[model samples]
Target chain A: MKKNLMAVLVGVLLTLLSLSLIEVYYRAFVPPKAEVFAFVPSTPVEVPEARLSAELISQIQGDPIMKWRSLGSAYEGEYNAKVVDVSKQGPLGCCVLQGFFAPPGKVHSRAYTKHRDLLYDVHFTFDQRSRRITPEVSHARNALLAFGDSYTLGEGVNDEESFPYVLGTYRASTQVYNLGLMGGSANQTLYEVTKLPEKRLPDLPDQEVTAIYTFMVDHLERLICRSLCLTAQGMWRLNQPFYSLKNGRPYFEGAFSDRKVLNSFYTWFHQSAIVQGTGMVLPPQFTQEHFDFFATMMVEIRDVLKTKYPKLKFYVVMYPGSSDPYGSDLTAACKKRGLNVLNYASVDITGLAQKRERIAGEGHPSPIAHMILARLLNRDLPQ
Target chain B: MLLQEFWDFMRERKKYWMMPIIISLLALGFLILFSQTAVLPFVYTLF
Candidate 1:
């Protein structure tokens, strides 16, 4: 027994010694994956084409770029400090506290690509209620509420060039509310819309409303706290809003990390060198259940909006971007729930100059692409 | 400097068996510490 114990201890000692040496070599000599790839010239990223075009053509189209009042330079520190609790004023709210929003004012910042090319140096203006400013022409009785991730939030572009801004300014009688959050998911939108009647959404006028949700393929992974989503996005998703279906209804389950087992496993998995170094993800194949869950969330969101606005016209616009295997399954599931889907998956930018529809040095859609999409959506709007 | 002190204390106490365990723990601690500064940011930027 004594000899066996000694042998085991020595084995552990040798194993640890080998690992420590490798760690030293990796840290001292090996460059990060990003740095190593930076030397190679980057190729244009593939964005899937949108097939369906808008049918109802309107003559009231203008330049996607509009004007905004600048409130000077905004620092990253000050930007994070201006957080408002959109949920129940707790960490467990339906929408987690997004601290990166500039408080109720126009803030300017610059974005640079890895190649040192200036991508954008623009201003972002927030309204008095801390929403991204969308310029409205006239005080119209109808409302347009936009929701989704950064594409809907217009991350890389000026406020004037965002899809919501283009749509709001183009339509004279509709007031546009930009509920799109950067890196936001259906969880946030569901929570926001559910609480709309409670005055949480203070400025929304009670009238005919049209809610547009810009769907992305990756949102399926986000809906569930997938290992890839948690680790790749880092600590941000720790406090990300989590929801689960109970009796066919979506229930808020606090933050993603609030799930004790998943949080601990992913927290350890992210720190594990083997996982990080190789970029291997867990549950390598997403099953049909994942797609169904995502579609269920959309159903809940639709139901919430319908309860509030009886005449609400909800459109799920699948933004032209990366394609995934479960796209068809997800769309089918949404259709089963009687949701209106404007699939722009085949929206062709092939005729345009290569990469013209995208922002230079960044992957987000350019103002030109936004113009195309806005015009398509304009045709579908009820004037 | 602290590493040297730790080594000295281990030698004085004649805790040879503990040396490997301590080295293993310290090495892991050092690895994780360096990873946070060197690796995590690069991984995050990919998103």
Candidate 2:
């Protein structure tokens, strides 16, 4: 027994020695990089690249649940476009109440960098009544409602370059609402279409419209609040609405205000790769239910949207390509629930990496790609 | 000189416990050096 204990102790010592060496190697060779921590942003910091002013960036630092009161925290006006100030805003609610993330009549203008490190401007405008990003057209014979995360929101592109806006250009009579929330998941997109106020959802079927939910694999992490995608200076975001699966049915669990523990853990866990690869991650509250919940929410959104536009055709468009393990499952789920699904993996977004059509610093769909999707949608959307 | 003497003493006494201690100290020294470079971010990917 004595010999055995010594042997075991020696073995442990060896393992410790190995770890120590590895840690040393990491320390000796690795260069420090600007890393994002998984904590909810507190303390305003200057993001020189962002369009907002430095003073505004410093003001919105704090626990997100308490800080985010309204949609536009900072406000500025330019004849070029209506800009909503978000320097004071932080992570938003945990669950969707109005079936949307922002208030009505809001426009978000941001500056981003593309592949060559060249700068570009992007804008998102929400309609006055529906609160969705309607096309710039004044009068349209019909409308298209689109939703997803940043890519759908035209992350590195202008408002006119978003897929919804380009789709409106394809058919002058159709007004498209870009309901793509900045950091949304597929389930969150579904919630935005289904959870809005009664008056917000138009039940009358006077207009011919199409509702498309655009998604990418990256949204999976956002779906479960497993990661934080940097939005702006001092604007680390992940605190959107979350859902709970009870008795196999998905229900809203509330916003960041309601999920302090989960939010806090994610806020911390996302800080470093050391934290992530070391199993310092939080256990997800539910098994991968985004597919199920997404399907359910899409069905509900379709039903409610159908009440407004009789000619509405519901579609789930996977944008910037779909490479997630859940992509197929999401497609299957959407199809099983009677929603049309389109996989846009064929677009040669080589420009994204080459910085041709996409911005050099950010790898989101460029205006060229948005136009490509618009043309594709025009060809494929059910007439 | 003390570290060399300590190493000699550990070898003689078979003080395996000191291995972890020494390695950890060396590791800390490495971290101090490596943090100044760009390769540090990739270290965490090793799991």
Candidate that would win on DockQ: 2
Tens digit of per-residue lDDT, candidate 2, span A16-112: 6665566566456644334321111122111111433344223222213122122121111111211235543411222233333455554454442
Q: Please state what fraction of the native interface contacts candidate 2 reproduces.
A: 0.01
Classify candidate 1 by CAPRI docking class: incorrect
Which pairs of residues have clashing backbones in candidate 1? Answer: A49-A345, A49-A346, A49-A347, A50-A344, A50-A345, A50-A346, A50-A347, A51-A346, A51-A347
Off by over 4 Å in 1: A1-101, A114-116, A195-206, A229-233, A271-273, A323-325, A350-354, B1-47
Cα lDDT tens digits, model 1, A268-383, are 76565544554434554456777777778888888887877877888777664332334455667778888877665544532331335555544556665665667667766676
List CA RMSD, all candidates: 11.4, 14.3
- TM-score per candidate: 0.67, 0.59
Against the native complex, each candidate's DockQ, computed on alpha carbons, is 0.03, 0.04
lDDT of each: 0.58, 0.50
